[model samples]
Target: MPRTDAGVELAGVSVRYGSAKQPVTVLDSVDLRVGAGEFVVLVGPSGCGKTTLLRVIAGFARPDSGSALVGGAAPRPGRGAGVVFQQPRLFPWRTVGGNLGFALARHGVPRSQRPGRIAELLERVGLPGMAGRRTWELSGGQQQRVALARALAAEPGLLLMDEPFSALDALTRERLQEEVRSLAGRLGTTVVFVTHSVEEAVLLGSRVLVMAAGPGRVVEDLPVPLPRDPGTGVPELRASPEFARLRGHLTEALRPA
Candidate 1:
């Protein structure tokens, strides 16, 4: 199993784009700490640096100022976390198993052990026996599932998702949301998800961090106490009064001031 003790810490982290003389700050002195095995969500309107903060945690982009750490060390690209992006971004030339095999190879798994690992990962993501299917042959939801399975191939301690289900149909989105929440709990993996929907944030996050635009900073850090055990269905949770209250609070927080 992947290490479940990896947490995140950010202190005074900032990012800027464009020339120094005419810089556009994207994140301003953001301070955050995500505990191990916690599901944290980032939600806000456009231009609020949600993606930027995700990138920082993934080590894809360095902070212009301050510090960002994952598992108590500076994050390095492809090091300690798995990332799922808005698009599936699978290799068109590779079959479902081929794609997952690539990830396993990168993680230094032996070739002899790869087939079993690939099967296990596919099963975990609800894609059992899909190793033979071509990437183009699968539906959008299947493609995304493959993308997710690929990310989990190495069983990284931390998973970062940037609006991963935004393009899916409503039913598919909801299903995937439940799968992710349940999977994270079962595996004890730390998750940091980014979404524009307040409902999604409340549904999946143990802690929701509401961000604001204009140099992008967190304005509200709220805990969600809803039950997320395997037996708790999404529909039941969504209809609960506590869910309604948390959703309303996050929605109100995003409104323009």
Candidate 2:
């Protein structure tokens, strides 16, 4: 379970696009609260505004109404949380170390100290001694590993991920899911992850929130009591009866009412 703290809180949040007279509502009056160190997953059908909600929390999208707060304050554009998108979006021209150094620089970390920190971050993400490799030289999963390292360079208390593993193949996605859940648990980093897969949502989240389509609103908030095993116990966890039951329950919940 997650402890109540100054984590993420949304109040009456809503978003709309197009002309006011004929606007399309993407998110309706929605409210949510996530505790510190909690891994919160956003699951929904396509066009259900999962990414839009993530953007709001990231301070990238201003809501049409209501407010979003991180750490009990309005999100500071680049200060509150580190964001990871679907694509690695690394600087193609930069080496892995260079990319991480750029992030450290933005955070005002001393130039001489970046190498050790970059190395440490790479090691944390399971990519060691590859910092000098060009971003283009790494595989898709490797590039994303670097991207995760870069995001953690700031050591943010909150991590907002937008379908980060969606582009990876099955095995890669599963591996990353296990890695991220373990990382979040070990670092006590609060995460709000968006995904379309029920199994993914259940596997990574301490709390799974399901949203309804057509002006997206949360319809279910389910807690996962499974143990956190990093990557070691993932296969067994997924095969458990509890996991299967929860997965089936969420699948049914996704059906139109």
Candidate 3:
């Protein structure tokens, strides 16, 4: 059931692409509700419209039909919602600090405040002194941290992520996931994350929404009762009875009969 206090709500949402002559449905009627300050992960097989749902929440794409709300208002593109996509998507020409400052500037943050905000954000994401460094000079993980800082600078109510860690190595991926979990908790920011990895979902999300293939739709939405910490690694989690229970549950829900 959809609740007003939910950080985000998607009711009977659907998205379609392609020309009218050859229309294609990417997402079927999708009903999802992410509570305030809740971490919700959307997981499904590739091309299951996981990203499409995130975009809708971020207001990047208008659903062909149905309701999509962020923080109680209609989805508004590039506003109120901050997004971190798969790639860092930083401007190659700008230094790390400058990239974040630009984001603040766009939101009308004063010039005097931009520097402090940039520094504080960088420090929060563990990239404290790399402000002047070009984005390309940093490692993949570092670049993603910068991206997180930029997104947070906007002080968005909802942070939408689309496979933000898919490109990192296994170790780096795990490390970033822990950081993200901690950061989101600290900021009390709501997040709607999209990922193909179940381990990542359980580790970072309070609730995991599993989608089925083709014209993707939510098949299962389950709460993750584990502690949100990096100490919960894939191997350690897999060994735990709870992890096995969740894995088996989601696996069965995601599989097509």
lDDT scores for all predictions? Answer: 0.95, 0.89, 0.85
TM-score result, candidate 2: 0.96
lDDT of 3: 0.85
Off by over 4 Å in 2: 1-6, 229-232
List the candidates ranked by TM-score, beginning with the highest.
Answer: 1, 2, 3
lDDT preference between candidates 1 and 2, better one: 1
lDDT (tens digit, per residue) of candidate 3 on 57-121: 88888999999987788988778878999999999999998899899999899998888888888
After aligning candidate 3 to the native by TM-score, how far in Å is the CA of 178 from where it should be?
0.5
Q: What clash pairs does model 2 have?
A: none
lDDT tens digits, residue span 45-108, model 1: 9999999999999999999999999999999999999999999999999999999999999999
The ten-residue window of minimal lDDT in model 3 covers 1-10
Q: For this target, which candidate reaches the highest lDDT against the unseen true structure?
A: 1
Greater lDDT among 2 and 3 belongs to 2
Model 1 segments more than 4 A misplaced = none
79-197 per-residue lDDT for model 2 (tens digits): 86888999999999998999999999998999999999999999999999998999999989888888888888988889889999888999888888888888888888899999989
Cα error, residue 57 of model 3, in Å, equals 0.7
Instruction: Looking at model 1, report the run of 10 residues with the lowest lDDT sum.
Output: 1-10
Q: Where does model 3 exceed 4 Å of error?
A: 1-6, 229-239
